[model samples]
Target: MTIDLEILHALSEAFGPPGDESQVRDLLRGRLAPLTDEVWTDVVGNLFALKRAKGESRGRVLVTAHMDEAALMVMQVGGDGLLSVRAAGKTEARGLLGQVVHLGPSRTPGVIGVQPVHLTPHERRQDLPDLGDLTVDIGVDSKDEAAGVVKRGDYAVPAAAFGRLGPLVKGKALDNRAGLVVALALLEGDYPCDLYIAFTAQEGVGARGARVAAYAVEPDLALVVDGVGVDELPDEDEPPPDVRLGEGPVLVLSDTRTLLDRGLSLRLQALAEAHGIPYQVLATRGETSDARGVQAAGAGIPTALVGLPIRYPHLPVSLAHPDDLEAAFRLLQAALSQPG
Candidate 1:
C-alpha cells in the first residue's frame, strides 16, 4: 500500500492535548471514514472504526493508538497577563522554558518565559527554574485582556512543526500519532478478523481512554501502538538500553508497570523474523503504555505492544525514523491477518 505523507504530516502536527482531542478527532474521522465499515466515537472522545470480516464470525481484534500528548493547563492569569500553568502528564519542565505553545480553539500563540540570563546573579545561574515560577506570555497587557482570548482551564501544547530530518521525522506528538498513522495504514489493507481501531485519549496521564475503549470494544485480542525512547545523544549516560530509532518496531517483553503476554510476544517475534521486518526486543524498568490498561480491563484481554523507537520523548521535539514506522505497520498488518 502507498503511504500518504500528507496525512501523516497533518496528523503529526494536529493539536490535541489530553482532555481536549477534538481537533485530532476531526482529522482522524475524515481519514478513516472511507476505510471503515462503521465509524463512531465514545463519550470520552475515543474514535472507533469497525470493519467486519466476510461470511462467518471470528473474534474481534482491537488496535489502539493514543491521541493525546503531554501538555500544560492554564491555572491562573497573573495581574500582568502572564499565565501560570500547571504541568499536565509527564511533561518536562526543563524543555518547557522558552518554548512556544498553542492555546485552545482560537489557537492563540504564547511563549514560555524565563528569567533573562543577564539578570541572574552568578550564584543562581546553576539553579534550574521551577515550574511554579514559569509563565506563558501571549503579549497581553493585563489579566482582563488575556482572559478575553484564553480562559483558566484552556490547554496548552508545544507549537511544533512537522518535517523530515534525512530519513527521520521530527515532531511533538509522534509518540502515539505515529502509531495512529500505522493503524490507518493497516486499515487500508485487508485482515482476517473484525477490527476495532480506537484512537484513545489521556494516555500520558493514566490511560483513561484505553480503559473505556477496551470495555466498549470487548476484543479477544488487543495490540497497542506507541513510541518508546531511544538512546541517541552522545553525552547520555548509558541510555535506557531498551529501544533505539531505525531498529524497526520494539516488542515489549516487560515494562515497569506490566508484564507482556508471553505467547503473544513470542509469536510477534517469530512473525517479524519470518517476514524479514527489522525488530528489537525492549525491556524497560519505567515505561508503560495503553496496553497495561487494556490487559486489566474486564476479564483480562490478551495483549501485546508494538513500539516505535523515539528520541527525546515527552519533550517539545520528539524524533522517530520513518522506516521504523513502516516496520511497525508491516508487523501489525501481518499479526492482524493471521488466525488466532
Candidate 2:
C-alpha cells in the first residue's frame, strides 16, 4: 500500500487538544469528503465518514482514530510574565521542561523555564520539579503586559519540530494522529463492508468522544487505532517487555478496560499470517483505548484494538515505525473486504 506522507505530516502538526478539535476536523473533512459517500460531524465533534456497502448491510463497521493529544491549560499569568499551567491530561512535567509551547489564537510561543543549575541548592537539584514550580516564559516582563496578548484557559502544547529520525518519525501528537492518518487511508481505499471512520475527540480523558460516537453508530464491529507503548531500552527488563518498535503493529489482547473478542483475535492473527503482515501481541497492564468505551455502547459491540508500536507514548517526542503503520492499514483494509 502506498502511504501519503503529506497527509500524515498535516495531521501530526494540526492543533486539536481534546475538546478543541475543530482545526483537525476541518482538515480531515476536506480530505475524506471526496473519498466517502457521506460525511458528518456529531455534537461532540466526532467526525464520521461513511462508505455504504454494495448490498444489504452485513453490519456497520466503525473505525476510530482519536484526535486529541496531551496538553496544558493556562491557569494564571504570574507576576513576572510567566504562565502557570495545569495538566489537561496525563502529561509528565519533566518532559515539558525546557520545551517550547504554543499558546492559543495568535500561536504565541513560550519556553518552559526551570531554575539554573548553578543557582539551585545541592539537595534540591536531584529532586524532580513539580508542575506547580514550573512557569512558561513568553518574553514579557509583567502579568498585566502578558494579559494584553494571552488569556486564561488557553491550551499549550509542545512546539516540537516534526521530521523523520532515521527509520522512526519524531514529533508531538503522533500517538493518535498517526492512527487518524491510517483511518483516513482506509476510507480512501476500496473496502467491502460499510465503513464509518470516526475521528474522535477527548480520548486523552477516558475516551469520552468515542463513547458518544459508538453509541451513535452502533456498529457490529469496531476497531480503535492508536499508539501503544513499546520498550526501546537496551536492557530487556522494562515492565512491558514484549513489544518493540519496527517489529509491526500490535494486536492488543487486553488492557485495563477491555479484552479483545476471542474470535476476532484469532481471525486477525490468521489474516495477518496469511497476508504476511507483521504483528505483535500486547497485554497492557493499565492503559486503555476507545475500544473499551466503544464495546459497551449499547447491548455490546464486538471490538478490536490495533496500535502503532510507539516508544515513549504520550510524550512530546513519540516514535513510530512507518512499516507498522502500513501493516495496520493493510490489516484493516483486508478485514473490511472479508465477508462479515
Judged by lDDT, which candidate is best? 1
For candidate 1, write residues 1-340 as lDDT tens digits: 3555677789878888888888889999988878889999989889999988655546799999999988999999999999999877668788888999999688899999888989999999888877777899999999989989999999899998988888888888888788888888978877678988999988888889998899889999999998887776666656556567898899987888888888998899999999999999986647789988888999998899999888888889988888888888889988988838
Question: What lDDT, from 0 to 1, does candidate 1 have?
Answer: 0.87
Tens digit of lDDT per residue, candidate 2, span 165-276? 9977878888888898888888766666788989999888888999999999988889889888776687655464788888888999899879878788778889899999
Write down the worst ten-residue block by lDDT for model 1.
Answer: 234-243
**Model 2, runs deviating above 4 Å:** 236-240
* Model 2 weakest 10-residue run by lDDT: 231-240
Q: Scored by CA lDDT, what does every candidate get?
A: 0.87, 0.84
lDDT for model 2 comes to 0.84
List candidate 1 stretches off by more than 4 Å.
236-240
Query: Which pairs clash (backbone N, Cα, C closer than 3 Å) in model 2?
Result: none
